[model samples]
Target: MSALERLNGTRLTGTEEAFALHRRINRTATDYPRDSSVPALFAASAARHPDALAVVQDGRAYTYARLDRLSNGLARRMLAQGFTPGSTAGVCLTRSPELIVALLAVLKCGGVYVPFDAGWPDERLRGLLARADCRWVLTDRPEQLARRLGACRVLPVDEGVEECETAPGVEVGGDALAYVNFTSGSTGSPKGVAIRHRSIARLVLGARFARLEADSRLLQLAPVTFDAATFEIWGALLNGGTCVLYPEGLVRLSRLGRVIDDHRVTVVFLTTALFNAVIDEAPGALDGTETVLMGGELHSIPHVAAALRRYGPGRLVHVYGPTEATTFATYHRIDRLIPDSGLLPIGTPIQNTRLYVTDGTTLCEPGRTGEICLAGDGLSPGYLGMPELTAERFVDREIDGVGERLYRTGDHGTLLPDGSLVFQGREDDQVKINGFRIELGEVAHHLDRHPAVRRSHVTVSTERGERSLVAFVVADPSVTSASLRHHLRTLLPAYLVPARIHLCEALPLTATGKVDGRALLAAHDTHTPPPAAPAAQPVATRD
Candidate 1:
């Protein structure tokens, strides 16, 4: 049978029991917490693969031995500067080998690092820096980034420095915070998701989703700021594997293919948007990749079908999770494509993470969509400094007769009879108009599914007490506002359809290549409506 046929119709490997076998293998607890100190995980990896390449960036590679040396020196220097354990530092640089060193250095020194999206505007950058209470900022040099980091100590990585070593063995327990990653919120605000050392270990250890070997090279495509990047960096480094951090423009199809061939990347992870881009535009570019891991927004899926036809089913593995549950909590090994919609099911939960589909406090039955609640060390410590907000979202719950706190993902999804999951949109991503709730993702999803549409975004606005639906999309050059609106009306209900359809060459994306909804929303000014066909493109092209 074709790979697509098996993925579409076959039962998963092993029996169809309910206890979640994948979860069993991944979530064993140690005598102490696993995440308490991630530096130790690094230590373990370094010890096993001391001479193996750890990080590769800009054509230069740093082996585990070098990483250990650099981390030690950086840690001591930080300690010399009066830095204490549990302190927070800011990391503001493009994805680079040096940035990887800096993160390890901070962790080794018993400090949590805040990786700011270097592509954020100066204003947004300043706000995140201030909120993190950062003691220092590391960057390439004294320019806009340095100025934006404010009064924090600035480290210029270009300057030559000595590599430091640990004092034989350094000890710290597992309850420490690893890092705080800031992400966009529904209410025009940003929230910092706090991950602990144990959670990181649990997440990686929890899922035997991929083969682990010292020679595996994970492609680092996500920006340093996003949680996806964190998974790429730590997942590879801690597993005695090498992390291949792709340079900036290399994110493009032709360029991305070049990087894969040049570095011989064994494992590659791309966001849904990126996966679609490569499949639709350059499916031939991925000649060297063995496995393609994906998440962070569901792809159009037809795109995945195309890739599967071109490259066998073994190449695609659909990954799903939010930052609230570490990098990812669900996995679907796509053996083949379905005829309708091609929606790949996000299969069973990962190790140590407990996922519950609940109507309220009660667990939901299979095939019912409900709020997704995650319980485990994988759950973050709630949004930073927002207790009220935290309390409302992160709740204490009892499952399987055990007590634990679960993070209310705010994401809605259903458990299939097969023990897989199908994601719906966010619970609050809905915008109310004329007393009716309209799902923005639903509109965007429909638009992008259109044959001509390359990408799309839908944002609602209220002016003078009236709500409006505006959409930005990249479609066939010939498509116009009227054509798209007419098409959307047929797919969605009148109320759910976009009122204004603006066409663009491409949509603005965050530093991580996730659509920058804020920027698209900003293009909608109150003075006058933007044309369904925007003449000017997005201000920035994110790598």
Candidate 2:
């Protein structure tokens, strides 16, 4: 039998054993039972650590006690308004402590917080509000938001909130909706993904619940519009961990790590691109900080190795999951990622999360490739208001007469010999070029594995009647587009090779920080002159 066949569930592979050892990342030993309610966890944490700081920004910090009050007042204010059970309240705020408080309040008011982006183009934002049928928006001033939203109601969250109703509102429970997150659609219109509170609780509460001390500071770098922001907000406040916020802007977050250190910040999560920036700009200055969770996109292992050599291991925690499955449902505790290990494993599924790789109808055995199916409390109800879309993505099957809904992660992977999953990106990412179906992630994987390419996005662009393969890459100072493409040709078939390679300063990212393939395609121009031949030195870190 191959080494991968010897494993069941999550056993270590021979290949993995050849590399560095993984630490105690899986929380199964902790015996922490997954809870069913999201609000109760927050309430319990607040009660247990009321005086602990829950959020911070530009010298501003909010304690759990304060967070409770703010959210309660806001909830009551929302209740005072006509926000009945299931009432859709939109929040168009940036990432901040108040944003969390506002979202929680909307939740407490027996309504769902449909997160809208204040930074979205007016047309996009308007389209989202209209599609969501958003009755009102919680803002500093609803009047302005109201004008843009048409007849929809606007409830100001910052200023004075209306009083709570004398009578209790709807009693929302596990299955009730929590929030709606919109993903950019291919057709230019965004698709709304509805998430239930059960999924939210599972991802946040199931993990080992460490007490967030009075001083544990977590920086809020993601925007509230993105689903991962939910983790930074809830993950901290629900643990009594202080979540520090950065004002919404185009500034690179790595630039502010020093300021975070100056404040004795303890923890912060970053998308891979942002994490690499900190590594390039200032590496060691981040040693004193606590956990640095990274996921959302592919992070280079060699780059991580260099960081480990410069700073230390155990500083970076690689997490993975789609917004469809809460912020992050899987994690790989990495001390170091060695090249001989092959593709990076997403590590193990978190607490209550159970992952399986199946070929549509049949669950594949170990070492076999299949689509990733996630079964757990973390799975969202599915796409919002898109029943056909929701039903299509969420597959319900009867296992021994018990029916359970499983999420098709759209990703494909092979069960590792070690029982950990090695991600292969979206199955749809696999496209037929020259009669052969190739996983874009596979080509991108080879690129990431390349010593010279720091990070890359592989895509197919249409030219006349042909689909031309292209790769937009951010690379080490030593690499070039020609060199990178040449490296790929050695491993992949000629037709699969990215004929046109563009050495980018950085990969474009969506608001949620995932690599924006469409955005790059839109911005790309094959006719443009090569960038004035950049010097063979460290270019300033790209955002």
Candidate 3:
């Protein structure tokens, strides 16, 4: 039996059942035979394709030679300024070629790059920088950030634009710290996830999920501060592919369609919500792309069913992972139509990764739901500067014969009959309405099945001391709340049906483009409840 088969608890046997099982739970881990540092590997790519196009932004292009020289100059300057190994530096800049240069330069100088969003408030930025203890900050506009970051050295990327000697090489180990990214915490204070060079090298170098190559042209669609950008930028740079960066604001479907076609982008990644919007508004937006990787929320596969059926050029892949898992832990390729259930499984673990669905003590059996846990080289070191919080989320567990560290994803999922995983909602998303438990994801799944309904978001709220469920839906202008409630009644129980429904032209989105449930709940609170239709009247209840 192969090591992979042993890892997955499959025994080798001369039988068709074992053959089918081997094909069912199979993923090939990529082997890294060269530099583990992302920057060093990118430099090697530049050596091979110096004159190739490396990045294109706003009608301007940058070649691999230019990018290499610019980042090398900046890294030399940073090294002269005492930014050395084990030092953390903040990168605060707008989305452009300079942002890419700044990030690569930080990595090249052996400094941890803590990327800051230019659109964030000054207070939040200040707090995050302080928490990270960044030694210096790199940006295009030092004047703008100087006041907010008192005493921290603010270095401008434009300085020393001419090529200088490359920074002296440092012996960087795989375990050396690389970058720190802050997650949007539920407690209002973001937690910084500290990752290492090994984790990043495993994710970027020859990753199969991305399908990036020397000739691949990948569009950088996510914000620079988001973790998805890590895959977009390095996946291209490490493989000698071209990184096509989009403009600064949210990209609409029309603009996305134009950009992909104009640039002949071979690969791109989008949030699940954005992917659904494109399928609903412009089904042919990704007609020419070779691959599309999307995740971050429950996928609306029914909307994408037609594209798969037509055998379009693009291969739609659903990638699932949390911030702690280095952006991609599991992936599922949608090559066929989804079953009638309108649900897609969050497939097996990626290269060098192992997953466990546990009920906090024992492993879950097939078709049983449990908390999703992940362990592998891609796991982050821990939450930066927050040991207690880190210990709570990243814990140790005994799996198979050895004890390994795993990150509790706080996501509920189940193993399918064929060894795939089906995502249930977040642990907190399981709500109790009038003493009846309901999975919000299941309710949304049924609601999306309606022909006129494009998307649905459900949230529980209390008004006048009476708690009930409120559903916000994106549907045709003429679609009524009564029709939705009646449609849902046929699929869900009476208690599971939302007590109130609101139709909107488009669902509101968070900064990261996920459905904003809190915003919808607040919007529903101010409006008076609508009268129920005669055929969809609610059962009598006591408050």
Best-matching candidate per lDDT: 3
- Stretches of candidate 2 exceeding 4 Å from the true structure: 1-36, 141-143, 159-170, 206-215, 253-255, 398-403, 429-543
Candidate 1 has a TM-score of 0.75
On TM-score, who's better, 1 or 2?
1
Please list the C-alpha lDDT of all candidates, in the order they appear: 0.70, 0.65, 0.74
For candidate 2, the 10 contiguous residues with the lowest summed lDDT are 531-540
Q: Write the per-residue lDDT of candidate 1 for residues 336-428, one digit (tens) a residue.
A: 866775557877776566677777745556666788777777888888877888999887654443455777777788777666778876746
- Give the root-mean-square deviation of each candidate in angstroms: 12.3, 12.1, 12.7
Per-residue CA lDDT of model 3 for 1-543, tens digit only, reads 634444453211223442343245544456784346777777789899999999998687889988988888888878877887778999877678888888888888888999876545565677788899885999888988787677689998763465754645866667888899876443435678988888877787667676878999999877656678888888888899999988645566667778889999999787665665566677667887898887766566665685576545349887888778888888888777556887788888787777877776666767678888888888998987789988888887545445567898888888786777889877576554322335677678778889988888877776643456788999988789889887876544455577788888778899999889888877664457745422111112111
The digit string of per-residue lDDT tens for model 2 on 1-543 reads 633343223231232232221222222322333433456667778788878777677766777777777777777766665678787888866555667778878887777888765534455567777787787787765666777777677766663433332323446777888888876443334678778877776665535322244456666666566677777677676666677776544444455756577667776676665566667666765777767777666556766776778767766677877777887767777776756865677777786676666675555556777787776677887765678877778876533223446787778877666667777766467553322234676677767878877788888876532355688989877887778766765544344467678778888788998889888888878554332321111122444
* TM-scores, each model vs. reference: 0.75, 0.72, 0.75
Question: TM-score order of candidates, best first?
Answer: 3, 1, 2
Off by over 4 Å in 1: 1-36, 167-170, 430-543
Off by over 4 Å in 3: 1-28, 33-35, 310-314, 429-543
lDDT of 2 at 92: 68
Pairs of residues at least 3 apart in sequence or in different chains that clash in candidate 2:
4-417, 11-418, 12-418, 13-418, 135-153, 136-153, 266-290
